[model samples]
Target chain A: FRKRQPSVASLIQGIRDGDKTALSRAITLVESKNKTHLVQANQIIEACIADKKNTLRIGITGVPGVGKSTFIEVLGKYLTNQGKKVAVLAVDPTSSLSKGSILGDKTRMEVLVRDENAFIRPSPSEDSLGGVARKTRESIILCEAAHFDVILIETVGVGQSETAVHGMVDFFLLLKLAGAGDELQGIKRGIMEMTDTIVINKADGKNKQAANLAKIEFTRALHFYPPKENGWVPKVLQCSALENEGISEVWQTILNFKDATADAIYDKRKYQNKFWLLQTIEDNLKMQFYEDTAIQQQLEQLTTLVMNAKVSPFVAAEQLLALHQKKLK
Target chain B: FRKRQPSVASLIQGIRDGDKTALSRAITLVESKNKTHLVQANQIIEACIADKKNTLRIGITGVPGVGKSTFIEVLGKYLTNQGKKVAVLAVDPTSSLSKGSILGDKTRMEVLVRDENAFIRPSPSEDSLGGVARKTRESIILCEAAHFDVILIETVGVGQSETAVHGMVDFFLLLKLAGAGDELQGIKRGIMEMTDTIVINKADGKNKQAANLAKIEFTRALHFYPPKENGWVPKVLQCSALENEGISEVWQTILNFKDATADAIYDKRKYQNKFWLLQTIEDNLKMQFYEDTAIQQQLEQLTTLVMNAKVSPFVAAEQLLALHQKKLK
Candidate 1:
């Protein structure tokens, strides 16, 4: 509502005062479409990017169940118990309107959400990739700038497109159930190839045997996976999110993965950020060049011709390119 | 190797005799792009199209080590035992240098390969979707024309792109290890959403509890999945491919699914076929038109200017369209 304001002054002051709410709001300001805010947001982020690079970014995903919230709660508690400042950034892909999540995720992580050393923020997917709401990547930078040691991102569907999460994180953990029957049929290889760690949940009580069996099967399966450049093979473990058993073990695995992959982390993060930058540029060019006003007039005609097989989308694209060149000349 | 040259009179007589080898040679001739050979090949397949649509197309996919081969052997035997014909068309995605999978895959399924009632052919992926070996889809039609009652497609890799199997099959069954820790995570929502039935494999020995728990978890997960318009909700079952237990049950499940989905079958198949037809046409047009001699010069120049950002790709596209429009006018 208050549009005419000095955002730069507020941003610097909030950051200096170490305000998480201010940092989140500032990130929202950066993602806002208003042209002026884009420039300002970019300025603030650019100033903080150096400090942000040191934060450990982790991407956690699975199907709706598999207890994502409970795991995060246990993981968050464990991390904070070790005196680490942790931020849990969750993107619930189920529409905010539809009560679609496996659990009322935010409400379920009550203990961790209330922790002083832990910060939990849940964003509605707004129909984005697996519902990890938009701009959460940018928000991670802000969180890192604000000094959250471990930043966890959770999404809904983990299809090939879900590799976007893989691109943004330093370590990728795949959470599995105690026994995923036909474990082979349940998962696709491409997703498995990207995983840094695979944790099987619900390993407590009667489920222990199944969980251990799953672990053995997964370890065997992991062998076929090509070794990572840093020579770190994904580790498989069993845990019960409800019982809080083996949560610490999962934490230890992550720590080991970090230690093993530490030297490559900065380079990996930088390269990933660059990849995003180029991808965004390509996307914007496609939209602005091909989808906008000047092209719209010609596109309709091209579509009709192509639909009738009189001309092709290719020829039309070529011709359009020629026109664009002429105009620029 | 001796060239088996046939006399012109005998070749004509052989066609009249309905010789299967002649028919297969004719089909292969049609699929070849050898300019002269293509003319003959096209004639044969075109003549055979009427006979091709009768095959019962089945698609089978699972992650590695899901006993996909063992299950296929059992199903092939069952079909053969019932006095029906079966063929397994496996597509392996590993490079041609993997000592030609066509040879290795057949060796892996010794029983089915040796059976006179069945045919087993393993093909190299030729580097495409779902490890697509060239013309395998077309080959299904050929197999059907040649009187195979069931055409089973076994694809390697259980990942996102493997959904290509879904489009081509009457039934899509996913095999999984009974209890693998990463089952839930590895399976992903996309895979869960696409599968018609999930059969948890290796349900023997100590993994029984794991299998039961997996069934429970999968059942719960399936509840969240919106029922297919075909009224077929993917069923979860336990099976030991090695023990041959539940093989017949799996077949019955497939039959049940087919009978139930029969009503929606026509529309789904029609939509899928139409999609591929239009998609192929679009790809053809794109490659044909842009690569045309006339469009080539202008496209290169425009690409350079646009790539340098000296002129926007849009503006360059616009100029090309104008020139093409002028030519048409």
Candidate 2:
């Protein structure tokens, strides 16, 4: 008998039982833009929060062709072989712009895709910043509820998506190619600073020497950067997805990092949650003001006036705020 | 006749006539937090905007002991000797916090203070982000209206103020001391990218060789950074404010940069004005929302709840926003 409808409680129950189908449906709810789905998504997240399980959220980021998919596939298989359940999810906002998802293709990680212990989900198709952030974060909660101990969140290092992923994850890994012109070009400054571990991929064959040189260069470069709050120095490692080499070593480095910064990480997560709360409030407030019809009508004209320097920015802002206030009355 | 009343039109007229006293008064009005003074400030700014003159706005940043003041003094004197009026303004928010203003003190620049062609103003006492940015930017307009052909806006490279300074200036110069530990310590990443010219200060005497070495290192380091939209390569120069050597060369570099990126600089200012307009609106909206009494009252509890993971950040934000919306109704 096919069940046409299911209540939110039953969905939560199924997810708690580690049902992959329930996990997928739960993520769909969170990713949905519909108002009814959003409410249900919040309810599901609330229920999951009450029964939260521990998750090692690792964020992986690299430029395309940096072997990110291969590295993830190898790493995912390694963990699954160790008897840990793995879920690989993506937060690639650019995927929608490119007309297809980067990690959404099922063929890329064929082994991981078919592995019973491993689940792969692509990024939601939504493009709104707030919407995407909300969905990805909620999906993490659902994934954790489904007892996925190792959740790998993949994102392209090109844009603001790296920042979003960095905020949500416990560990942030930057995958880079060896001998790529100092291994720094095309990398954003903030993203480099946020990187917890720099992994040089495709280091198996003749590239081994270059990768080793890169490891030294990155080590020296990272030494110039101030140590993060956790006091664990960011490390550079060499890995070869083709040979399935250094996969466990990277995982061990992550474990050592977790051990070294347990207290700071715990406090950081709490602080981050509080930060997101305030940030959400700030964003919502701005959205409300900007969305007000009166403010919207005057925005273009005021912008032109400001561009022409006919009015000071502060005064222009006051005028718009006054318009919103007056209209509210 | 003792006249205490100066209408906005007369103030603008006096400013246009190069009356230093009138310029100072206009700047004071712009810096004022009083609601009444704000209206007059806008009028003065509006009138001054119409008569905007061609001025070279350079943003200079360095550490406290990086010879920033000495460099400014030498460079200011150099420009003034060439029959150019120079205005040096500090955006050192910390100076106010430290119980003394860096540029506010007249004794620091004994020669420049006494020079008829130079004007120096310290950071405003108000510490709010919007207040500081608004005051400094408006002061630039008043200084330009008062016939200051060269405006050197100084900010400590340690904070967000440098970014604000960079936004309003045509040229952003970073002053560094040679042999100062690679000369990159404590400087933020984004700051380096925004720099149009990196000047190695104190390059005279025994520091000359180290300064040259630092220049080379910086050039190589900067190569890794993406080029700005203006298509001008960021140059590194050696200067000694102590001996007044390289002052002319630095000025020449500025001239060359102006020649190379003239159109882009012009477009940048217009785009910056539009950006500031939108940014100011967003800030004001957030301030209004955050300043709501009921929302403030519940903020601490909500933050703790979010931190404890008892509630999702979005739900907490929704609750707070709903409360504010209900109160408005």
Candidate 3:
């Protein structure tokens, strides 16, 4: 016989009492596509928001082979050792297509996965980055309510995932492999602007000298960027997740950033809240308009006419909007 | 007595015959906010769309003091001397507030303003960037119909104007002073990614060596960026717009870029058309939602609640959207 599912009230109580199982179940509800589950998830989210403890949300990103998993594992363990309740989540939108990449294998985190104070969750399988980001954001609140003092969001630094992760986190860490030519090829266009710290990973063994040089190169490169709005200058450091070296220094830099930008952090979160409020409404509005059968039928024809310069894009947009409004009526 | 307004048919015929007066009048209609003028503007735009000649649209941007007006003057004169019809336009969203900082004074381009083969138009006074961009885009079609072989769009690079200009043009040019610390300040985060060429201005006499050094620095910096989507690599050039030196080289570089990216240009324009279609629709949708008095009344309260973590932003958005839908019903 299958076990009975717990009610929303019991789940909330358990999460408040720091029950990892209840927190995971609540997050599952948040990730569900079912209509009833959505309503229940919102209720849980509402309750959790009020009960949330002080939390630090850090987003870590790097290319696929940049050792993001190893770095995260070591950092998560470090925090747990400091008596912090740590929660690890991934935001890989491509997970659904890749059948789960980052954090998919629980064995990747080995020691951290087995730790009593650590909770590790794989990315939700979602077709859209927006969907995955929403799930991860909600999970953050749920994790916080479960008394997780530190929440680490991991994403592969490709496509628009870094941007999504950047929006949700307090500090954004970009991991890079030394001598990988990332610095020479340039990091992605906008990624550097969003980064708070750059960590050159695998800085052990033969890679030590190269990693230091890479750190210096990145430091000089970071100087070119305009001052960040939060008034915290971005720093570059070298680390070796393999040897477990410089991990504490990375953590220390983050603490320094947090201390220096305390007021800015409050303002950033407020701005992020407003951004999400508008973003969600806009996303839904577009989905409603684009999903309409009548609009879809005309969109292709209108797109062709606009592309060929036979009709002004503005006029075509006006026509479709009129049709949508008429359908609504 | 007021002169009689030209009929839409006459205006179209005149623009087709390369009449500057007709082109100017049509653009005025495009910029007008009056409902009747808007209708007439659409008719003229529809007519001109079919009559458009093969034209190259180049967007030039720099900070206010970076000699944008002088550069455009020199470039426009060069193109006109090459037996090409040139039209210069500006897209300054801040024009209304700044009392028209750019291209506001026709005397700034005194030589080009007097050339029968060239037409210059100041930016329309619009409160929003979208409004100004739409006007400039429609004006481009009208100018192309007027047989202008090349269109020059100028914008101040301090804000989102460059992005608006970038979206509408076939080529994007960034102008900067040699030692203005822009290269060291990193140029704007995403500006370099969109640029096809960087022109270091005022590279004459005392500034020539510094300009060349700046050029080398920029070339190295540009290497760090990933290869652009269009297979063509960006080039850096130094020019003294005041002395009209290197102006021809700038033109040559543009010609070379056009030759190399001819196919990409076609594809880019198609993509831009679709982008504008969706952009126009989305902008309108947002306007409709935000402008509703009832929605505005509740938005602030919801924003505060979301910022304080009392309500999920997603939930607040849903509540507002439902209210909006119910009101519509």
Candidate 4:
């Protein structure tokens, strides 16, 4: 059996049979290192992509130790308890820097990890600004093929550079603690304006009062935010991930959000897919544009000229374009 | 006189002698359309950059309608009254969409605009991430050459991207509102950690308690922040920008920050300058690399091949690199 190489068709069939190992292996094919696997991966993806319509894709991010894993573990368990299969994909962006994840997140999410109705996959947000989207999106399809009803994407909060996940996900959830309201001053308003919902995590204990006060303040603050074009309002929720308080209510709010904007959700997903396609093409073009060989010498010389003040940067750019144009002809 | 065709040396001399018109013209000269002025511009920059390290560079940002203009006006007046010359560069980023500056921040800064010890310039953040560095860097040297003691860079508070100004400034001040503490959940935490201080604006009137409460919350939150590697500790202070309350204190905090970090400021500047230099080189290289005809066609063809699964992105990248290496020879 080991002698028979795994094929994309077989992988897809395994996923259809609800094989967890196959789902994991299919994800690997999607994120494969071998060039030969790309064709098979693409084919399997096209075939196994079942109607991923009912699934809720939520991106949960917070500064480290802000209870992302704990919240997901509790929330995943809650959703699974309600007769839904929950899939959790926790991505560690810091892994790319440190070579292997802190690996602490999985341990924190022990309950969810062990649940028969839940599937947990912790991925590495390898050195891409579109962090985890390529792998995560493909992984979501595999989970859907395996009949998981809901998907939760967990990303280690990137501080300010969060657009990568936000642009891809359906619902973007930001978790924050009480007492640091002023820290918001340093964050960009664009990111705030883009958030779908913001959760005040760790809302129990002595900080309970501060958390309640924060919830009220955030509600008023949400009023100032321009309504998202989808006509869905971003709600503020207070949750004690440790105590599992308000967990079901939080899930209820998400369902309410889905029911309120079902039509728009599909439309948004279509647009988001289109955006990723174009974006990937554009990014590749930019990468290729800069890493070409023929112009390497000319580019180096141009930089030297500009750096030495012998020419303007604009002129250098123009000259390079002119040379490139001539060479292309 | 209108047709004087003023040489750049004469322009620099005039700017050095406190000629407001000349200073404005110099900014345009650096931010020139003709491109030829760049060579002359750098000569002047090199000349003026010498013996001009006394200016305090303050970066100020806040969400729209958060009193950034009003606070700048008040702070500008306060600095000027202390017998210190000030220059205000109000960056208008939203103009990219509107195609014109809204509110004309300089006029809103009435007191500072009228003060003889102050100079105010409001320009669109056209190509913000690019243009700000070009014009503002030169403007700072020009201001320093003219003996201005403080240079306040008022940038539109667009989250995630606002850090561009933070890197270029000596002190990064994030402005917030008193009761509007809830929106903090939506903003990023990295910017907060990068900030030198958080100033709560509009702190007077019915919002006093909210402002005090915000201060207490901020003090507690700052504890979670990792101390700045530059040996700077971010502080939270309450100020009423509308009433001009705490304006002097705000300026004093900046002064104290400089004094405390005096020994490392030069090293920081050197590192920052080198960073920008490498950044510029890398950005330019990227643009030129794809434009090179030697592999442009091949790259595009490879893209389709990859898209169709004939090749993987990694292989495409490797092939492109090989071509680049050959071209290097």
lDDT winner between candidates 1 and 2: 2
Candidate 4 Cα outliers beyond 4 Å, as residue runs: A1-3, A13-22, A47-52, A59-83, A93-133, A154-168, A171-257, A260-329, B1-3, B12-22, B60-81, B94-117, B124-129, B155-164, B172-247, B260-329
Report iRMS values in order.
Answer: 11.2, 2.0, 1.9, 8.8
Over 4 Å off, model 3: A1-3, A98-101, A180-182, B1-3, B99-101, B180-182
Q: How does model 2 score by TM-score? A: 0.94
Ranking by DockQ: 3, 2, 4, 1
Please report the TM-score between candidate 3 and the true structure: 0.96
Please give, for residues A1-329, the per-residue lDDT of candidate 3 as tens digits: 75678889999999999999999899989999999989999999999887745678899988878898889999999999999999999899888898955787999899999999999999998888888888898899999999999999999865799999999999999998887555646478788889999999999999988898898888877776667877899999989998999999999999999899987776787788788888999998888899989999999999999998899999999999999888877
lDDT of 1 by residue, B58-115 (tens): 8787877778888888878988999888878765556344656632546778887888
Model 1 segments more than 4 A misplaced: A1-22, A39-52, A58-83, A95-127, A130-134, A154-329, B1-54, B58-90, B93-134, B145-147, B152-167, B170-329
lDDT of 1 at B148: 77
lDDT of 4 by residue, B30-135 (tens): 7675657776776666667654466788888877777888888888887777898988875555655566663354568777788998888765346545555556
The TM-scores, one per candidate, come to 0.52, 0.94, 0.96, 0.66
Instruction: Give the better candidate number (3 or 4) by DockQ.
Output: 3
True lDDT of residue B168, candidate 3 = 95
Per lDDT, the best of the predicted structures is 3
Residues A72-174, model 2: lDDT tens digits: 9999999999999999988877766776886789899998999999989998877655556667887888888899999999988645888888888889999
Instruction: Give the candidates in order of lDDT, highest first.
Output: 3, 2, 4, 1
| Per-residue lDDT over A5-102 for candidate 4, one digit per residue giving the tens place of the 0 to 100 score | 67777788898888888887877776666777766776676676534446778888777777887888889888888889988875655666766663
Number of the candidate with higher DockQ, 1 or 3: 3
For each prediction in turn, the share of the native Cα contacts (below 8 Å between chains A and B) that it retains comes to: 0.00, 0.70, 0.73, 0.00
lDDT of 4 at B207: 84
